[model samples]
Target: MDHAPALVVCLTTVSDEKQAEALARTLLQERVAACVQVDAPIRSFYCWDGKDCVDRELRLVIKTTRERATALQQTILRCHPYDQPQVVILDCSGADPGYAHWVGENTTED
Candidate 1:
């Protein structure tokens, strides 16, 4: 059986749930992401501007193809309210064939 091309799952954190939902909606509407899942009230610990900090955040898991990854990142950066948004692209494997195909179909330019 032939497998579809791999998908990229990008992760980004936002200050609140509202931002998370807005970002997810924009990405889906723009076709930059096939699907986006938002989870909130996550505690993140990181160093910023030479200071260590811990804060509550919402995480957005964005799914798309490698072809759309760059554009997706740019879109997230532009819409995000953070000076340095955490946009991590994860290489995905072993996805269900139908789901993978669906993602590709949705994320491609019309």
Candidate 2:
């Protein structure tokens, strides 16, 4: 049996590739995230100020340790342009041993 520390999987959508790249670069530069995958030109629909809104956005998937989740979220919130940024964190129970090791090695010291 193998027990490894949990990984935090966060998802947020941005307005464009520039925004997505900026966020990813900042997170990686600060070592807040091991890696960030960006999916651009996504269609999103949600409620805002009691009104429904639809827009094209880019989605960012950030990978980090559970210990860094709070800090990562705080950074995103502070840097995000939206009044209410869509930041969601999910827990990764298990991952490939090699990949997990790589993630741990790349991330900041926890």
Candidate 3:
């Protein structure tokens, strides 16, 4: 097991399950994400354009490394259906050592 100090998790919302799966597959295929957890039928309430809005969406939890973050963001933007997609990154202080190692090694360059 290889230990790394930090990992990166990307959270993004998709219009539907299919879109979520597609994005996940693309990221995995491109080795931009080691894994992606998809949660669908999520109820989202937020303010947009100074108005409160609610919608159903699917969320993708992408597991990767800090090195892959910028590229991952770009790919998500390219494939996302929304004009302005929500792609947020979380810094992880610890995780499964082997899994983290895999994530660090898998991603590609910009």
Candidate 4:
């Protein structure tokens, strides 16, 4: 809907399920994310420090508000195991009105 709340979608990868759970919980507890969906056993290919790398990872799909997106990202960076964790933020415009409202309501900061 054109009148939908301003939502934010973020993506990040964790090395394992424990880490995925911890980070997800932190984001939610901090009121930075309304929802965090974890998908596991995904193959990731990349290069770090000029070395080719391939590994299995869990991907977290995070839903938040534009206002809380920064806090969510900051929390991920602070709590993530990797020195450089992947944190991607996307705009969520024109979403279903009910869903957008839920995300906004759930992510309000204290």
Off by over 4 Å in 1: 1-3
Q: Which ranges of candidate 4 are over 4 A from the true structure?
A: 1-3
Q: Distance from true position, residue 83, model 2, in Å? A: 1.1
Please report, as a residue range, the 10-residue window in candidate 2 with the lowest summed lDDT.
101-110
TM-score of each: 0.93, 0.91, 0.88, 0.93
Which residue pairs in candidate 2 collide?
A: none
- Candidate 1 lDDT, tens digit per residue, 50-77? 9999999988889999889999999998
Model 2: residues >4 Å from true position, as ranges?
A: 1-3
- On lDDT, the candidate that comes out on top is 1
Given candidate 2, what's the lDDT at residue 67?
Answer: 78
Q: Which sequence of candidate numbers ranks them by TM-score, best first?
A: 1, 4, 2, 3
lDDT of 3: 0.86
